[model samples]
Target: MKKLIKLGIALVAIISLNACTEDDGFTFIAKEDPDGLTFANTPSGSYTLTAANADNMAERFVWNAVDFGVQTPVSYELQGAATESFDNITVIPAGNSTNVAVTVSEMMDLAEEAGLDNDPTTAEPNTGIIYFRVRAYVGSNGGNVVDQFSDVISVTVNLPEQSEEEDEDLPKLYVVGNFLSASGYGTDWTATDGVPIAAEAEGNTAYEGFVYMNVDAPQFKILQTNENFDDNYGDAGETDGVYTGILESPGVNAGTPDGTGGYYLVNVDTDALTYELTETSWGVIGNATPTGWDSDTDMTYDSDTQTWSVTLDLTEQEATDNGFKFRANDAWDLNLGDTDADGSLEFAGDNIGVPEDGNYTITLDLSNPRQYKYSISKN
Candidate 1:
């Protein structure tokens, strides 16, 4: 009986050893190792691109097939970068192929985004080496799962010359209806003398400016071009503080002011179909100002001069270094600072330094929509 029991135990040990030895799973490896890829059509030498031939073909990059060590599908990608190490890179996929053709226009965008100037006429010729390499990987989806990179090659690119044309001026916006200095509605009663709001930025479709809306002229609509009843904007009823809520074309349902009428900053965005009204107020606040940065010393606006001014006393000892900034509505939403410390105000810029200290009258001139200026005069 003891001999039979020993034989049974020996048989079980042999079965377990066979099972463990037969469980060898498959492993993945680079078939070509990617690093050994040869570029069959990599462009060499320098090339110049221009807007005249922007749509023309620049180059077609071709590379050898990469093996993912299995029948599972593989993908290829062509990448370009400003640096040789692939830093600040842009990539284009090859679908399921090992080649890609690039256009001059597409290459121009890539060069510009890589810190090259789009205009070659005025700016110096952007002569630098652009690096290119092929990336081979498994799966078509996007992620950090990369397999290998082909040998890198470089080509020099010159900035493309583009034709210079002055940007067309944005159409003007006139205040219509009874919403300004006068109290009357309709196209005939054009508020040409009311207030002209111009575009805040060159290509922006938004216009903004200050308008004094009183209880009498508390409501208004905007007119495009001539004071014709053909087109205008009314209310869209989207949210609070939106005057041009719904557009009313030839029809009229002028929007009303949110709060008591006063000199308010009215901003209109036609593309977004929205309008905003903010009370025009300014204040000087900072560690350098008499009042600390937490609170602002209010500044008053003069309609005649079209400027915001304030006179306050400041001491060198009080202003610990971080100086001061101009804020609107006593809130951080709209603030200006001298980023360059050159006595001019930049929207959302750094704090202004107190060049010494004493009583002084500060004036902010925003008359020029493109150029805003401010002056600190010793009292």
Candidate 2:
């Protein structure tokens, strides 16, 4: 009876101690990771699972080690599954390291098992996704040992779709800069999310567009494309004031226009390896402002908040029903009108109706991407 009592007390203590590691409503996955496995470098892109590049490292599976709050040695194993459902699982033991790699050949096997093929005649898909996960466990995943699983990562794979026509390389210039992250476009200085400047036409050297960046001294480079950084253009340390700056092939990031910064009308000459920046000044234009439909009432820029605002008297013409729109450089080339009349701005959208005639404060905030908004407040 004493032995039985001791065993019962021991089991209770064991369950109480292990309760901290328990994760409910999950299968081999942790509810939260105090220091759970995190991927280090999983470069983005699709894969063509072919034997030609079999030995090439598809993508290195990297992650931070999991901490079960114990000193026991932890071992990791890489896992793959057909879909988000872990019903069909594949495992690759990675020993005790926190990082491992899945080669093209190995991915090819997984692809074949997932019923993907390069055959053009069959109903099987040439494109599919493979989900990945890594397991962290102590004591060889023995009974009651601490173990946790990382979040699933899905990778798109293709079996090389057959095409009769060759793909044309449409030359494009993507502006990769430090201002992107500040402006909330994407990762700073990364071509993967850089803003694009397309060629004027086929076989043209001039690339023109507008990008709103708040960096006082704009530091940037022009990437050939958004996929890879194989080709790029950047500062050659030559400048003709804020109007233009010289560019060099395969160059590092560089700044332009000294102190002038705001929305810019950019023009890039790829052949000459030079670029120009035209700082745009925005204003309210239409028949409603002090300047009738013919001219624009200039708006002031607030660098602290990165907005264009104006306080002016507006006339509500109930007769002719005239209204105003926002434009840059006192011109129609770069203008915005609210198509939905929902306080949002779209390129060359419809004219905005005046709410009422009054002395009002209007503010335009272009700091956020695709969420350009304007606010009109009566003072």
Candidate 3:
């Protein structure tokens, strides 16, 4: 009977050891807390997925725990399906991480699989749809499995339009100058020579005329002409060894002759107009009398032939004794018309008869002011 009791105790002990060993068997229970997190309600753009340990137990009690020696390396995998059964799900390796960039299309797919009409097409069938979702993967020495899925997200895109008036309102460009008026009208204006007159609109100012140039050292040309000759007769001459003159007495002709030639000799008459030009207030270099005028001193207005004549014969004593040298000022005068005519002298044209000097700025103001464009500059 004692031997029987000993054998019973040994069997009991063996059973106890078997029960402990069976309880310690390597069995794993995957516990993913919350199962899934929904990101469909979040804003669009970029995001990062984070892992949360759900178990309150020590790290050793958690199977495939990241802290233990079970070699739990987490990866991510994306899945899209039409239903919760996930029978037709498409699985892609999300790589080795808990975070990944979720695309718009994937978000739309996730929304569709969740039976949610978050996709634009699903909500408004006329439009297209974009879907997205993400799933984390837990890898262990034994095997691997997807832990949970995030909520789905969706978005839509559209383009804008433009108008015609906006395109037409763009700024326009114009050439820099003034616009010319009808041709050949005396009331119209003309531009200075060599200097171009431009029409341009810049900022707030629209320039419609020639720019007034600064006159630095203005100049004038002296014009001396005989006032006692007619178009038919030449200068007064010696007839029968007596000098025949055009001017009668000073009281009789009033310093000008009507060409009948009564008292003073026409050729010797000092009844010509004298024009003076100076360089910076100095005395004139060009001094001449009617007989002393070189060929350069002569000019003719073909349209009004009898209006102007000159001779070169001014003596050096006459020029020195009197301050009769030419003077140059800021202005010039026009004196080539027949003063005796009843407006018969309508037009006048003459060449510039001044000697070539240094550079000068010349401005010609036509009698009508607006008849034509004239240009003058240093050559």
Candidate with top TM-score is 1
Whole-model lDDT, candidate 1? 0.56
Q: Using Cα atoms with residue i matched to residue i, what is each candidate's TM-score against the true structure?
A: 0.47, 0.39, 0.18
Q: Write the per-residue lDDT of candidate 2 for residues 1-379, one digit (tens) a residue.
A: 0000000110000111232355311222211111121111113334555443354344456555555667887788889887788787888788877666566667777777778977666789966788887777777565666666666766666666432111123456788777887765678878787876656357989876667677667677778888777767777755422223777776656565754456776778988878887778899988878888889999987756768899999765421145788998888988987664445577787776553467878788765434466776556
Better of 1 and 2 by TM-score: 1
Residue-pair clashes, model 2: 0
Worst 10 residues of 2 by lDDT: 1-10
Q: Tens digits of per-residue lDDT for model 3 on 295-331? A: 2233221112111222233322211122112212211
Task: Per model, state how many residue pairs clash.
Answer: 5, 0, 38
Q: What does candidate 1 score on TM?
A: 0.47
> Which pairs in model 2 have colliding backbones?
none
| Candidate with better lDDT, 1 vs 2 | 2
* lDDT (CA) per prediction: 0.56, 0.63, 0.24
- Ten-residue region with minimum lDDT total, candidate 3: 1-10
